[model samples]
Target: MYVTFVGHVIEWRGPAPFYFVRVPEDECAGIQEVASAATYGWGVIPVSARIGEIDFSTSLFPKDGGYLLPIKNAVRKPQNLSAGDEVTVEMTVRL
Candidate 1:
């Protein structure tokens, strides 16, 4: 399924910094409908996404009843994105 949303970038300070864009609440419902079929394991859903001029594949990490789309450094740097920056994402849930 294809979906598009705009959200702010957030950082999780692990051993290394991890960045993500939270899927909007309104979008969660449709994702939940296909979650069971789409999640490979541990509630992680695989998706392909486009941000700015780049397209890449990544998995959505389930969190707090929603999903967080990881923004890899490869994609982020090219687009000049940083934490708290608003980004528009077009994604496809791979079912």
Candidate 2:
């Protein structure tokens, strides 16, 4: 299925780097940073894969009031992602 997720980069940690994205209305997902580069003075990271399984039970509220959700087995990095950068992501949800 094609799903559109709009969230902000909340946290980026670990050696491989994982993005903790916060969607609207307290929804969130993790997008693994696969590749990154500076383009036109803007940092652009290409998240080419998803992780784990899509489960709603892992949802929680961020300290800032937004919901926190894991991107399962995210295959991307979480660097340069700030805590409020409006992001529109398109991905294929698999079962």
Candidate 3:
């Protein structure tokens, strides 16, 4: 399954700090339907994600009641993205 949306990158200061983009509530709802088949465990949904012209693979983390799309440093560097930046994201769920 494929989905696209714009989200703001935010810094998450967990045990280890990282960047993430929240999947919109509407998209999250749709993802939830297919999440069981796509998620391996711990509500981690495997997906191929693209930001700008860069593409990478990562797992969507379920937080609160929504999913957070991790924006890795490799993807951030080339795209010149940082926390608080609004970015267009395209994701293909690996089911």
- TM-score for candidate 1, please give it: 0.98
lDDT of 2 by residue, 1-95 (tens): 23456765555577864446554541222321211221122222222233323222232224353334444332233333344555565543222
lDDT of each: 0.96, 0.38, 0.94
Off by over 4 Å in 2: 12-18, 23-79
Looking at candidate 3, what is the lDDT of residue 23?
A: 94
Model 1: how far residue 65 lies from native, Å: 0.6
Candidate 3's residue-wise lDDT over 52-81, tens digit each? 999999999999889999999999988888
| Candidate 2 clashing pairs, residues 3+ apart or interchain | 26-67, 30-71, 32-75, 32-76, 32-77, 33-76, 33-77, 51-73, 52-73
Candidate 2 scores a C-alpha RMSD against the true structure in Å of 14.4
Prediction 3 global C-alpha lDDT:
0.94
For every model shown, the clashing-pair count is 0, 9, 0
